[model samples]
Target: MKPWILGLTGGIGSGKTAVAQAFIDRGVHTVDADHAARWVVEPGRPALTKIVEHFGAEILQADGTLDRAALRQRIFAVPEERRWLEALLHPLIGQEIASVLAHAESPYAILVSPLLIESGQHRLTQRVLVVDAPEALQIERTMARDSANEEQVRAIVKAQADREERLRHAHDVLSNDRDLAWLDREVERLHTFYLSLRGGQA
Candidate 1:
């Protein structure tokens, strides 16, 4: 049988990476969708070629790699362009995620994604785990971490699913309003819970 897959997700700056790292400490395998997304559009890949064809070479940096900041600004400003990019990248990212998960050796694995629910990637997992924080807090955290301004962070929060909507889809929710120590403890608790579920002890 295949290892159980946990779909882990959160809005920007919601501490999903910290939680995922905690799981990794307990020997759980993890796949990050963002990494897969980037991989699918590498310098010489088909996705990059198609993207350049559609968006023009202007989307690329001086080093011939994608200029993510420029693309991000373009997408958020124009919804259609975002949709076009997602249409091209999501399937390729999905395939890469599936390929990585298939080889997971842990009793269970994690698929970490910022757009897990919104993009329907949660369907690949047995359970949905949402790392949640208030919208205001999310904005603050994101701005601080990314050196982004309030307006840019707010725009990203606006584009993502709201807190209530994300909570509605979660089988498990990790609150990230506190410090890393608190977050680590919460992850440990969930790790134990998942292990019990995996072993049929719960």
Candidate 2:
């Protein structure tokens, strides 16, 4: 049988990665949509071939790898191009996510994604878990980690589903405004809760 799946999501700069790592520490298997998205467009993949055909070879690096930064600039600046890329890549990423999630041997598996709600990836899960922090906190964290300016971080936050929207869909919410100790404790509590829910439907 397919394992119980939790959709863990949050906006950029939120503590999704930290919470995901905490779950991993507890032996939970996680399928990250961001990783799946990257995998689908790797060199030698059919998606890469199609992307090259559409965007031209200039989209690739000197080493023949996809030039992700260039492509990111293009798509974010052009909505049509973004839609086209999403149309092509989303299904492939979904397939990869499903394949990995099905094989999870833990009591339950987590599908960790920033776009879990926006991309419809939440449909794959039995419940949704949202990692939340304040907008200012998100922007600050992102700017520090990515070395991005405040404007850039704010733009990213704006592009993602708003805090209210994410919270509206959450079956569980992990507030990440505190330190790692609080996060670990919350994760431990949730881990035990999820384990109890194993074999039960959402």
Candidate 3:
């Protein structure tokens, strides 16, 4: 049988990675969409070749790797460019994610993605689990973690689905507005819940 997939998502700096790490610690098989995205565009990959063809070789670093920061800036600044890139990469990334999940040996698996809802990845899962935090906190955390200024972080936040919309669509909500200890407890609780769910399905 196909393993149950929990679609995990959050806006930038919403502590999604922390929650995913907690699940990983518990031996949950996890497939990260971001990792799949990178994998598709790795050097010598067809996706990278197509990207270079469309965006030019300058988008590559000296080591011949994609200049991710430059690509990010370009996509954010130009809607057409972003659409073109997404059109090229999204299918490849989706195929890679599917292949990874198919090999999952755990009773269930986690598909962690920042754009789970936006990219419609939630459709691939049995449930949607959102890691939520206040917008101000998200901005602050992103600024510190990404070394991005307030304006840039705010723009990213704005580009994403609003907090209310994400929560509205969630089957589970993990509030990340508190300390790590609190977050740990919540993760533990959810882990138990997921295990119980898997048992029931089995």
In candidate 2, which residue pairs clash?
Answer: none
| Per-candidate RMSD, Å | 2.4, 1.5, 2.3
lDDT per residue as tens, model 2, 1-202: 6679999999998989999999999999999998999999999999999999999999999999999999999898999999999999999999999999999999899999999999999888889999999899999999999999999999889989988989999999998999999999999999988888855353
lDDT of 1 by residue, 1-202 (tens): 6788899999998988889998999899999998998899999899999988988889999999999998889898999999999898888999999999999998889999999998889878888899988878888888889999999999888889887888898999888999999988888888888877863224
After TM-score superposition, the amount by which residue 132's alpha carbon in candidate 3 deviates from its true location, in angstroms, is 0.8
Q: Name the best candidate (by lDDT).
A: 2
Residue 12 error for model 1, in Å? 2.2
Off by over 4 Å in 1: 73-78, 198-202
Q: What tens digits encode model 3's per-residue C-alpha lDDT throughout 115-162? A: 998888877788889999999999999999989999999999998988
lDDT values, one for every candidate = 0.89, 0.92, 0.90
* Candidate structures ordered by TM-score, highest first: 2, 3, 1
